[model samples]
Target: MRDPLTVSGPEGPSFWAEHAWLGTHVEPGVVLDTGADGRITAVRTGVAAPPPGAVPLRGLTVPGLANAHSHAFHRALRGTVQTGAGTFWTWREVMYRVAARLTPDTYHALARAAYAEMALAGITAVGEFHYLHHGPDGTPYADPNAMGEALIEAARDAGIRITLLDTVYLHGGLTADGHQPLEGPQIRFGDGSADAWYERWTRLRERADGDRVTVGAAVHSVRAFAERDGYAAFAERTDGVPVHVHLSEQPAENEACLAVHGVTPAALLDRHGFWKPTTTAVHATHLTDDDIRILGASGAGVCMCPTTERDLADGIGPAAALQRAGSPLSLGSDSHAVIDLLEEARAMELDERLRTRTRGHWTAAALLRAASEDGHTALGRPGAGSLEPGAPADFTTVALDTVRTAGPVPGLAAEAVVFAATAADVRDVVVCGRTVVGGGVHRTVPDPAGELARAIAAVTT
Candidate 1:
């Protein structure tokens, strides 16, 4: 499954869209010109017809979707974990079993298939919240950063951009006593101490290129590290990079944090000066008012994984409230429960409607913004999610002629895309001026489903 998608040529490529959402509304007969560097040079609306030598995209085109959170290896557990009544804790036990079976080689295979699935779903960029470090028994491989590097390679092979959020997982669990020693499968995720994690991360970041893949730092969560200095040190080490952390996803996490620190997890992070402008709080599901205020005031973005949250019964997050308080909201397909950013976007609004028993909490355009521009911003791809001049030439077109989308007129095409379309509705995907998926099939990864089945078998059995 080597990459066959070509980047822009010396002449780049021209594409004409039947309709396109240019930031706010859908416009008809849109034309886009990409430069040699894979940046959009111009956008013309009302062209009515495709120019000569231009590829015609017959659908509602939107900016490339950004998957702000992902655990690629977890794709192996998709159908297997759906049985019986299980909590997140129980589901994690099964997940740990799969994690213990990974080698860097198998990981690359699995991640390649997982990322290719994301490509078919129209994801042009992904924020891999990676923590699978070291060997199975807590020993570093010949190359300590080998697992991290496999993810970078997998994204490249899938023809998508990735931000490797190299996470620090130093503790096994947080008990009332304090942080516990790394044990069992958890050991594979830890690096002895935060300083040691910093050393490995420093090396990875220095070697990581800024183009297709970049390195970012993560604290894992307050449960994994009670000490504040490690986070501070990591912040300094990854000064300009984005910092992401799992916030209060479950009520138990909030309880534990409050029991130990006398504050919410968000407040605890605030106390450590970890709330930088580029910081993103993943799954800020259970937050106090003060927690919301702190995140909003500190300019930290919130990434909501509604599909995964609902799947794991993690409860809905305060997305509209967070936005009202001044925090930007982004969507992520965390846990790979489903990689449809369109579903995630609508779930953000639909879940809110379920919670508040009201409607119109978020406009379709705002939800798309979260899945695109804001998500890219969270992943450190600033301004890469727009179709305007100077932005990266990355976009996906959804087929409005599909059974799920045929009723809507072109004027409300954006609404059809946001409210009706699924991943299957995406007919074409252009990333960095390259066609990764055309006509609902991956251009490079032949047999993504078969690849996924084989990769999962290698690990699970």
Candidate 2:
């Protein structure tokens, strides 16, 4: 095996993969050339062998996976929250307890390790749906954006691209009576009002690098935002940025929205013109036909976190219907129940099969698109998640000879990967022409598991 750690010169780097997935199909003996600026300069296919000095990626190489939605701190709650019987609402309480323990230093430590684990899973970029602002008692730090900045820095150290979705979370929960005030750990997430939230978001935007780090915005959910007009104002002000919101993840949320706003969460957001091509709805698990039509017609995308949905008993989403209605689908590892995007990808199809009592609801290629290109687009990184020229030089090589991925023919390798392979099968990961993980080992953070253990212990214990 060639040393993946070797750096290429001023002209840039070239990688030759045994088999490469070119969006729709797999091609053998493909060479991808990257420019000095870290964009794919050329893709030369049908080459029988690696040219001199070309890095040899001996496996099925695919575009770097994009985790379209994540709550980085939630990684800490993985095993701790699984012990007892609970629903999504109950899960939220456990999650909030973990949230309350986070300081800026500990947040950065945990997120860095979490993102490094993502890198090991072939993820090159992540959409951090961050809302943990202020101190334990809702006090702003010296720099109000300190926690947000910590996450961005953590992603940088983890050698992955990050879109910090600076979230505006006001109120605690919605009820039949009205929006409730923040209580307990929930107080840490609010920024007083929409104006105050946007002010902090504006300052955070100034830190965006526009390449590896894109600053975006999100409303935690309709239940968390009582000021209805704030959604419209946020939409208008942050028009071009990637906007995300937690849609109807639970039936109770829909019931509350209907009682308070006389519409489902989807309809309520649509009334404020929140749906758009750039906006992505995370965990849109429950939707009426009208909700589907509204989201699809607006060309907004949906991100499904199947593992988290299943772990929390959130019902299977209408992924196929939403897709047919013209909404592009994306996948995420929300709550970090599992960090495998392939698992998230396959679970979406497998869950849909269980729901409709049918197979082939989605092709493996289509599922990979959700994990890759469409996901990157939802995170404000358009023109990524492909091996075509002018795209970012980001890709991961999955070991075909691994125990899980061994038997598939070259043509069906993509199917083998999406259906059978896990994060452990990822052998190498490259982002922006830089090697972050090689030979199944992360380069920057040498021991991700150890880091994760230490970091989680700090906040949890």
Candidate 3:
């Protein structure tokens, strides 16, 4: 796959949208000009129509959606895992079975297809929460970072930006007794200790391009690290890079943490100086009041994967409270039961409404920000997710004439998109001034659905 950054000419490209969301409201006849470096150089509104050389984009265009947290391999388990009665813990056993079957080559095929699907859903950037390091049975490949490299290459082939959040997972599971040893397929995820993990991460960072591919670090969860002191040391070593951790996704996890450490997961991490501006906590479903206060005061971000949470029967999170307390919110398609960022955005608001028996906890614009701007920020792309000067030349157009998206007032285009639209409504996608998907079809991946079926069959069957 060719890099979109190098494919543009010196003059770059310009796009004219029939209607565009400018972060706050909808505007008609907007023209966005990009520089050769793939950043927006200028944005003009009130243009009557497409200029002679500008590419014409019909329907409603918005900044590209960001999938702030992802497990690319999980895309294979989508329909296969839905048939059984199970919790997140039970689902893990099945997921591990698939993980044991993957090689660098197979993983590349699967992730490439998965990422192409993300492109079709208007996701321009994905933060891959990757921990599947080494080969099966706890052996390192010729290249220890081979699995991570496969994911980076997959993103390139799929023509989307990626933040490879390489994860450090030391232990298999935490119990009231203590942290357990990594056994079976879980051994592939462990790097022996934080020092070794950091050493590998340092090498991975050296290969990161910092533009389309940013390398980040992650702690698998509070249970993954044994000692509290290790959190502070890991935080210091990974300073400045985006760090993410799974936090209290289940009540069982919180119960075990309190039993072993005598504090909630959030409080335990906060006591060790792990919460920082660069850190983001995923799930955050079972947080206490003090946990919320601690996370909010520390300025860490929260990434909510609404579809996965609902799929796993996790309860609604206090998203509005967290935002009010000063934590930025972002959305992700974790587990990928569905890959629609629009649905993820609306699900967060709708789930909140279901919890409180109230409506309009968040406006459509605010939800869109969670899906785009805040999500990009969480993935270390702060200037992306907006169609403005100096932002990345990434945007997607949703067909206003789609069956579900029709009949909305022009001013309420953002609302219509967030509430009514699905991934099928995405008509075009541009990333780094290159159109990856046009007319609801992917440019490079020829047949994403066929590729996905083949890749998933290779692993699941």
TM-score of each: 0.98, 0.97, 0.99
The RMSD of every model to the true structure, in order and in angstroms, is: 1.3, 2.5, 1.0
Query: Which pairs, if any, clash in model 1?
Result: none
Residue lDDT tens for model 2, 52-119: 98989989999999999999999999888889898887888889999999999999999999999999
Please write out the lDDT profile of model 1 over residues 1-461, one tens digit for every residue: 45444554685798999889999789889999988777888999889999998889999999999999999999999988998899999999999999999999999999999999999998999999999999999999999999998998899888898999999998877766777888899999999887888889888987566657778888888888876546666767777899899999999888887777788889887887888779999999999899999999988999999999999999998888899988998889988888899999999999999999999988888989999999999998888888899898899999999899998768888888899999999999998788889899898888899999999999999
Question: What's the count of clashing pairs in each model shown?
Answer: 0, 0, 0
Stretches of candidate 3 above 4 Å error? none
Report the C-alpha lDDT of model 3 over 22-91, residue by residue, as the tens digit.
Answer: 9889999999998988888999999988999999999999999999999999999888888979888899
lDDT of 1: 0.89
